[model samples]
Target: MFSIFNIHRMSVTKQLSFSFLVVIFIGSLLLSLPIAHCHNAPATTYLDHLFTAVSMVCVTGLSVFPVAEVYNGFGQVISMFLMQIGGLGLVTLISISYFVLNRKMSLRDQNLLQSAITYDSANNLKSYLFTIYRVTLIIESICALLLMIDFIPRYGLSHGIFNSLFLAISAFCNAGFDNLGGSSLQHFQTNTLVNLVIAFLIISGGLGFMVWRDLYHAARHFFRSKPRRLRAFAKQLNNHTLLVLETTAVLLILGTALSWLLEASNPKTIGQLSLAKQGLVSFFQTVTMRTAGFSTINYAQAENSTNLVYIIQMMIGGSPGGTAGGMKVTVVAVLFLLLKSEVRGQTQVTYRFRTVPRKIIRQTLVVLIFFFSVLLTAYLLLLEFEPHLSPFALFFEATSALATVGVSMDITTKLSTVGRIIIMVLMFIGRVGPITVIMALLQNRRREVTYAKTDIILG
Candidate 1:
């Protein structure tokens, strides 16, 4: 599954994959220099900075530093930049920007970009990427303005602007690196304005641009607020987008309720909090755990059941073509649909009255299987190294790292050097995802020119 000599003569996808890792590694190394030299850096170490940088660039949000306390403005800024690039996804950025600048993307480059972002090759790549950037910037800008209203009075003008912008980007990118580290929004958990604004950003970001575009068109029909009729234009909503959006909404609401119930009885968790705060925290937790790594409460001390909920949420993660990571809600939906079809003894899986293609069903199954395998293997490895850690903790950490959710059982700081390295690798792979990584590896090789058909007995 791994080879060293195949580094050269790699396909465009493989080269792009290699370049992404290099970019992250080099960018992090360069950014860490200031942190290593800074007087305020917390117990600074090379590996610590490297791990933090990898996590940030991966948009995983798991951290060794307390964030607000550990580094000065400079370090935080570096992290902000990394998260922006990571969340935007390097391939999307480069391809769109290159096309914008009138640069030609070779066929190989086109393939690389498509594979990296999980977009179909048949789509208008340049236009789609450009739309993604424009929509993202516009949404982030609006979120910043709304957030500034809350942050300005509290933190004052300059600091407020910085915080608002940073938070907006973090939220929209689903990066979860907060400036309010140790304070952890504990004081303002009930603040509806801040909480809802952040939640909106996280949801919108994770929803994927394709879905947003569909929803935007769908929303236009109701501008007059005449509820009786669905506008003719409303029929334009793509089945795929609708399915993904519906699944995401269901998961968010259901996961929030489940988490609240699980933690409601634990005094150390959300038990002591007010109803409003509890609701706000629950909403935020549910949204963040899926892909965004932010937490209003101490995740390390979360009840075992709460951690279990989080692990499940992390595994579901975000939608396709979004900054958020995971096996993806759409994939999960496809698998369920496949299962339903199998149980019914139907030849084809159907959803929302639309029949799913066999190729798509096969792809979804492969993705889920690969995702679970990677997650389970990582969990087992962690257990081998740290036998004393609870199974739930190990599972949570693995899921968080693999899903790029950045939630932790607070075991990160206590991890040995080897454990940290393992985490770093997991974060990298998590962001790129197992499917993409495997595809990248296989991209260079041609399929067998002619293959003999083989017959196998059914189980």
Candidate 2:
């Protein structure tokens, strides 16, 4: 019986692992289909298609090809659809659709969904999926409407509508590819309406659906019934939600301020704009810097200080369970809280009136370590092949690609085939997540009790 149970568990894990891999692989295959030729589309390369497909399907936004010049309507449409699926999270989408079809989700499906959303309790899985799907459609629709007001006049009704929808999906998914062209949003750097709408969409999307659900429930209770009673009865809200909100606000405001100050004197940067425009551009940059992928100004023209700030923000992406990728805001929050507790000599790390588990702290440490190791290794390897590029540029590109942030310094086009391949791997690793990869590869071994114990002295 024990052997059978072990075998079953292994089978389930393997099945899930392969399913996840296939989603990405097939997504790339679909994206690579030949369509109307564009400037960025070379004669033909399977590796290019694989990389582009992976980037789109992963919602990482890192692209070897300039989106505006390379992909046609058909290819762009496929990429957009892939981004939507990737942003919604493949597991979450599958689980929700399964539920809507009146089918029972197996325990394995539930487990995978739980992992995908990082839900603490199994009981809330159904509610969580429903909320995710509902909110995603609602928010994206509203964002599209607002964006249409900006896009329609500039590009005409047909192009405007399509552009609005593409951008809405792109921003909400946190995928940075823009059909607006190679300079990113430089053409609209002074367009307050377009910039603001895009920023709002990106912000809404970056704040994971879990946080949206929490806020929705909180608001519903506030308006509907015995609000006081509900508030009193409610225990601690999810730590994940609080962390997401707080970290998001901090990153946006601080990132904006830092970028504005850093680029205030640069002729080619934000200094050329009026204070109001500068503020708007800075705010928009902040929104896109953390994995949204859109940019109002030329990132290449930005000061080194600004690029560094952007890199840090990109490396610490929005939240877990969102379209954005990075080490994640929650991980950074937990790590800081852990440090605070240790410095204060406290035995427990607490945030938002709740105690954090040691397991979470350990996980945060592991995530940070894995992120650095992978990024460093990739950066070093790329340097060996492309000795002409600046180290900072290589490091910046590696981290941005690994975190799935689409910002670039224009070196992407100059990279050798090998360099591009290395980045493709980083994007995949970024999307699948270092932790998930670790889990999939590591064997699950049981530990036995030992009779002897020994201690070693430490300084």
Specify the highest-lDDT model's number: 1
- Over the stretch 353-394, how does candidate 2's per-residue lDDT look in tens digits? 679987567667888988999999999999998899988888
The models' CA-based lDDT, in order, is: 0.77, 0.76
**TM-score of decoy 1:** 0.88
Q: Model 1, 293: alpha-carbon shift in Å?
A: 0.6
Residues 1-459 of candidate 1 have per-residue lDDT tens digits of 556445445655455467568658876686567643457555667787788778877888888877676667776777777788888875454663466556666777577566656565476887777788899899989989998998999899998998988888888988888887654555667788888888898888888777787777677755645663564545667887778877988898898888888888777778898877777788888988878888778877788778778888899898877888898898888888888999999888998788997757666777878888887888888888878777777788888898999887777777778778888888888887654654554355545587898999999
Q: What TM-score does prediction 2 earn?
A: 0.88
lDDT of 1 at 20: 61
**Residue ranges of candidate 1 with Cα displaced over 4 Å:** 1-9, 35-38, 90-93, 96-103, 106-112, 115-124, 220-228, 231-234, 435-459
lDDT of 1: 0.77
Give each model's clash number.
0, 0
